[model samples]
Target: MSERKKQHFINSVMSYITLSLATIIGITLISIFISFWVTELADKDAQAINLSGSMRMQTYYIGLVLERENVEAAQQAIEKLQNTWNSPLFAQQHALLQEPKQQHNLLTRHFGIAYTNWLHHTKPILMAMAKGQHKRSEIEFLLENQVLLTDALVTQFQNDAERKIVNLRTFQLLVLLITVSVGSLVFYLLKNRIERPLSQLTETAEKIGAGDFSQRVDVGGTDELTLLANTFNRMSESIANSYSKLEERVDERTRALKQHNIVLDFLFQTARNILESPNGQFDFQTTVENLSKVLGDHKLELCLFTERGEKPYLQLVSHNKAFAHCEQTNCSECRNQDSSMQALLLSRKTGFPITIGERHFGIIDLQLNNEQELPEWQHALVQSVANQFAIALSMSEQKDKENRFVMLSERTVIARELHDSLAQALSYLQIQVTRLQKSHDKQKYELQQPIIDELREGLSSAYRQLRELLTTFRLKMDEGGLQAALENTVAQLRERSNISIQLDYKLKNVPLAASEEIHLLQIVREAGQNAIHHSKGRNVLIELIQTSDNKVQLAVEDDGIGIPQTPEKFNHYGLAIMNERSRNLGGAIEVQPRSGGGTRISFTFMPSITRQPIA
Candidate 1:
């Protein structure tokens, strides 16, 4: 899921959780409050109604004093009290008061047994209380039952009320304890299972945002909160894991891209050189050879394919002696055709094309000895190289056209100079010779000989200058072959300077395009020049190493004056140019101070001798 969606879901879940918890708490509070209110009401109702039995007894006492037929009336009042006591109102009152005092002496003895029986036998008491109605013993009996029973019942009621108050207080205490326990439990549960974990999750998220993906949260329960915690922990873990992986991948990709850029830059510079040269011709064979030497054992097979209608064909081109040839194949999947050529043709989708505007020049294709699919990034690098090739080719073509015009202009100037100076001088000399012949004199002959000698000398100088120019041109063309170019450069360097030079070179046998070869030569020449001009020591070491990316590297190191100590001093034009050249070739130049007091200029290029797709 998208991060936004995931965040929204998490937020929604938290909102719901908050609402649910709020509802549960609200319900619990309301329930407790209702219970408290109901208890209070029941307590008040019990106190109010408990006076009924006492009031009825008082009335019966009055009836007895009047000596009327009040026994039945007292009995009726007693019956009314009993019925009232049997209902929920009296039951509520009794439950609140009776149970807790069951084991007590006053309540159990007087209230529970004696007082209740006297109330039931009130008819006899009232009758005895009537005037002239019974013997003294009976009257005494009546008064005993009436006074003692009423006194005991009243005392029982007071004691029961006090005990009920004590029980009610104890009940309130228990309720308070239960409420506290439940609240504490909820807080503890929330803390361990939800709160703490959520806090950790927030911390983890912050850490992740800060580019640290190493935080984790603990899971403590199987409730919804626990499930949420587990999910959050997993999400954090995933983020950390993915972030870590992403960093590593980015780092790896950056390095690879840098390397690829180096190769591309090299190719670009090489192509540019080939294009900008006075002559438009370039040597691909040498370039391929140098690339192979630099790349090592993963063989490079260079092919030139001309756009044959809508398709491309493999035209084998190589410089190394170990290289094989491809013939008459259209596709790699064509079993009946040359497998290598067929493979080359079939692998066009993997190959990057060189194009300029509406023009399609060609393609540079490389296949690694490995079977793994090229990573997308590497494929992109390949395409970038192809694009550079197209630009380079276009620039070279334009440069070639411009060079032609320049050449024509130079040729015209030279011809005019020869005509206006040398030709006229020769013509004048011829005329002078004719005059001397006619005169037939010794002085004239001597003058004619001097004139002829001067003319010959001038002509010879012109010829020599032209030959030198041709020689220079040949050298430039030969420089496209990496090995030839390196040899030629070393030879020239050795002849020009007193520095001793060593070259170690190895590469695949494939032929590279002319543009590729020329850049390699420039790289070699730059290294040699830097060594000669900057390094104050004698010996200079140059090595060409190839890597898996179908690229070649030229490293020059010398036991001489190292790179400047300060950053400003390090910004010398030569070093800057060298670095730029390396970058243009899609490579890097590291000018490190040698451990033993020299400068090492190492250039690393990608798509190295063995080209592989990025993974």
Candidate 2:
């Protein structure tokens, strides 16, 4: 049987109970046999005592007749006594308990000896009396020891029988206790293994029936009841989830209805901020602040393109407490782009350009900080807000040109209209692919392991990046340059490993391009992973220092076993990725053994442009 069905249900429990009851009954029969045997043994001892007493009495009567010189009567009495025990008719009724009947009994032999001695003493007196030559004074000595030996034997046997009865009683008491203990233990096991879980299950069911889906039974053991409990818990979770989703839908619709009425405030707010400015021009501070309120909790970056030969003006606004010190600072590092990376390492990054009919003007970048993905509804709402911005921007830029405004309005109409025709047909192909992947070990039969692995890696990375998109809503990014990025990397590693991952910053807030920061971050992450996976490193120290040659040095040292003599011994994908990132940074990576028996991996990047910080 499968493991699930082998468990004992109610029927099996009853079967075990019945078996226990049968065992008790069998034990009871054995106990009864023992008691009966004890009783028979006591009776046998009593019978032996009685036989000895009777033989003594018969001997005394035989002696009295001999004393009266009545030899014939005496002879007849002795013969009757002998026939009662030793004759063929009485032999069937006579036996020792643990001996064979062919063996002469000591009691019978001693009794006959007493009889013969009496005859020796009495015959002399009887013959003398017949011949008128009797002497009576000497005859008393032989009678003195008469019946004494048989009386002592009877006392000894009676004492032995009493001791046997005591032992039997003790044995019976022990048997009774054993039987009671066994019964109690069996019932105890049945109650714990079956009754308690059943009771909990009953309670949980009642709670669920009362619409309390949060309640659950704590399932234990490897039995049918455990399986039942597991099923019950799953049912409860499903009900809870259904109710939760229903409530969430109700709340979402209510909020959408409320927000729908005030959604147009975003345009008025932006225009109001611009008009309120002293110079009557767009202001980043007011624009970003008002825009952030409508978009809720996400980092907002607004940039307006200036004329050629001038840098674009950038402004950032967010409600995150961690970014309080970074206000008004440049966040150019946040815009790093690595097109080759399948995963958006920065997560949910969406950018909308402020343009009117191909006339690019400004830009808006919205993102989250943590790993929580924004729901599809929220994404649509944010996109709707961005559309309003686009319209406002276009209207502001073309206040005098009605023809251009009409052209700008047609762009939105064209984009939304395409969704009805070609877009819907492409959706069908996506559905077919989804179906194909849902069969035969997720379509692994048609794909090799490496292909499957690559597919999985791409999908996993994309899903993670998408999910974490909204959580990046938190503005945890530092405007303090590479130093802040390294600190963030160290903090991430420390959270995952028990090993101490400390950062030693020797360089000031060195100015690195956005691309340089991303490359450095990837290299640091890859190096830390290599230390953990390859060398089983414990202590990892990250250091960033300016080299004597004016280049920046980033090193990760570990107190682990040194690397192999040949670096190419293993297919080190992480190492390869790290090297690629280093090359992209215009740097050289060094791998060498540490002096104290570990590995120190370092890389140096020279500044590509002749740029220096202001003194």
Candidate 3:
């Protein structure tokens, strides 16, 4: 609304209300002033009535004195009443008392009659009393009549006052009724005109606040209330408009948030799958197939760069099951560089780098075949997915390298043991053959029985050593810890041999490293194997105990022909393998004769580690 219109509306409302109040107050005040004036006029008339009665009494008494034949008292009384009546208080001769009437006329005429009659009645009594020959009966009669007239006048005045009082009370009641009626009318008008409109505005505003933007107040009249309603309606429209836009944006954000959540779930699942792979190997084929399902129209490829014949080779494996070209690890057939990869990444295809530290192993190539424009967020999501898998890939690569290193080191150790024990024993068999040949030639075909038994013993020992070596290589500790592996080995040994085997174990729940536990269990196995195969013992005892000094002591005892006491005679492949494993375990071994005519082989290592750090 314009300022002019608003100002005019305010002025109109204020002026109407102000005029109503002013008219009501003016009428009430005028009526009240008139009532007060009428009451004062009645009071003055009552005073006039009283003064007239006093004058008549004075006349009556004056006449009484005259009747008593005291002319002087009569004169004095008459003069005193005249003096009082004509005093300055009543000196306004022009002034006349207005006679009281039963009915209200604003102001009556012939006002001087009351004063003139009152004075004239008093003059008759005074003159009659003044005569010297005046009869007592006449004076008394006159005085009694004057008293009666005076009583009648006083009664009239009292009656007039009562009537006036009644009239005033009636007028006051009328005035009160008018005031209440006017006030009620004004309140009703104000309530309907202003309060009702303001209430509507308040209700509409509350509705809008409660998210009901469709709410609008009905506008009527060209006043400030109407302008306010119009403004409120406009505000509601604006709110509704803004809310619609905001709702659209909110919906868009919600959809985007859900999409991001889906992408995040896929990435997390991919990471979990990679970590859960066997021996920490990456299962790319299943992973990419799941990815293809999530990103349905895209072709996925896992490209790995490796060296073949000292040259860089790029291996590319596509998502299609029939599209297999090269192994993920051994990419020997691939003959490609960055240009070939760049060509492989066609116009519709994008490549996210599969990186392990500084080197980019290869790209995770994606070919988007759909017509829809790929969102930048999806591309960024693909890059993030690639980033996550790159870490898993890096870990898998490191784990495989560790496994190969472990296998190579084990092979070298086995080779060293075979050369140390079996190689030397076989060479000694070559010497035995030479000695037998020399005896046959020198003793002239008289072969020594001791030499033949020695030869047969040597062959049996060599055969046993070969079988033990094979068994050593075949032995593998399972997921069940050292105790379980030990029990399993003992059970197998008992089944393989006729000797009675016994096991006494105390090392339960020992916190040993994987390598430490594996070597320790294998050491026990090799010990048991040797006792049964080489010793010809009937019974064997294997005990794994934690010593008082916090060292793990594994002992294998046999009731059999004991090992040669000399080091040279005891040097065999099984013993050699056991010594090498003990050195690797950071422990010590002792081979000695048992107390009860048996062989006792014991290896002891610290409960945790053999030694603390050098520092």
Best by TM-score: 3
Candidate 1 runs further than 4 Å off = 1-145, 214-615
If the candidates were sorted by their lDDT against the true structure, best first, what order would they fall in?
A: 3, 2, 1
Candidate 2 stretches with Cα past 4 Å from truth are 1-19, 87-146, 238-615
> What does candidate 1's lDDT look like per residue over 183-212, in tens digits?
666666666656776787788778778876
Select the stronger candidate by TM-score from 1 and 3: 3
lDDT of 2 by residue, 1-615 (tens): 654355555435556677778878888888899889888767667776677567668757766876787867866766666654453422423444235535645544454445444446444444454344655454455334656754655665566678888989898898898789779967976898689988999998898899899998896766666778888899899999999999999999888877765555665665565455443344556556665666566676555553231234544444533232123443333222223211232244355545556555444566655746755545555555445555555555555375566457445433432332223334544554454566555656664544456556555644543332222222133776767877776776677668878888886645666667767776777687667656676798888888777788889999988889887453244566567679877777889999897889999888654355666
Indicate whether candidate 2 or candidate 3 has the larger TM-score.
3
Error of 2 at 426 (Å): 96
Candidate number with the higher lDDT (1 or 2): 2
lDDT-better candidate, 1 vs 3: 3
Give the distance in Å from residue 568's predicted Cα in candidate 3 to where it truly belongs.
19
Per-candidate TM vs. native? 0.32, 0.33, 0.61
TM-score of the candidate numbered 2?
0.33
**After aligning candidate 3 to the native by TM-score, how far in Å is the CA of 169 from where it should be?**
3.8
Q: Each prediction's Cα lDDT score?
A: 0.59, 0.62, 0.72
What RMSD, rounded to one decimal, does every model reach?
21.6, 32.1, 8.5
Tens digit of per-residue lDDT, candidate 3, span 377-429: 76887777778677876787789899899999888878886887688778988
How much does candidate 1 score in TM-score?
Answer: 0.32
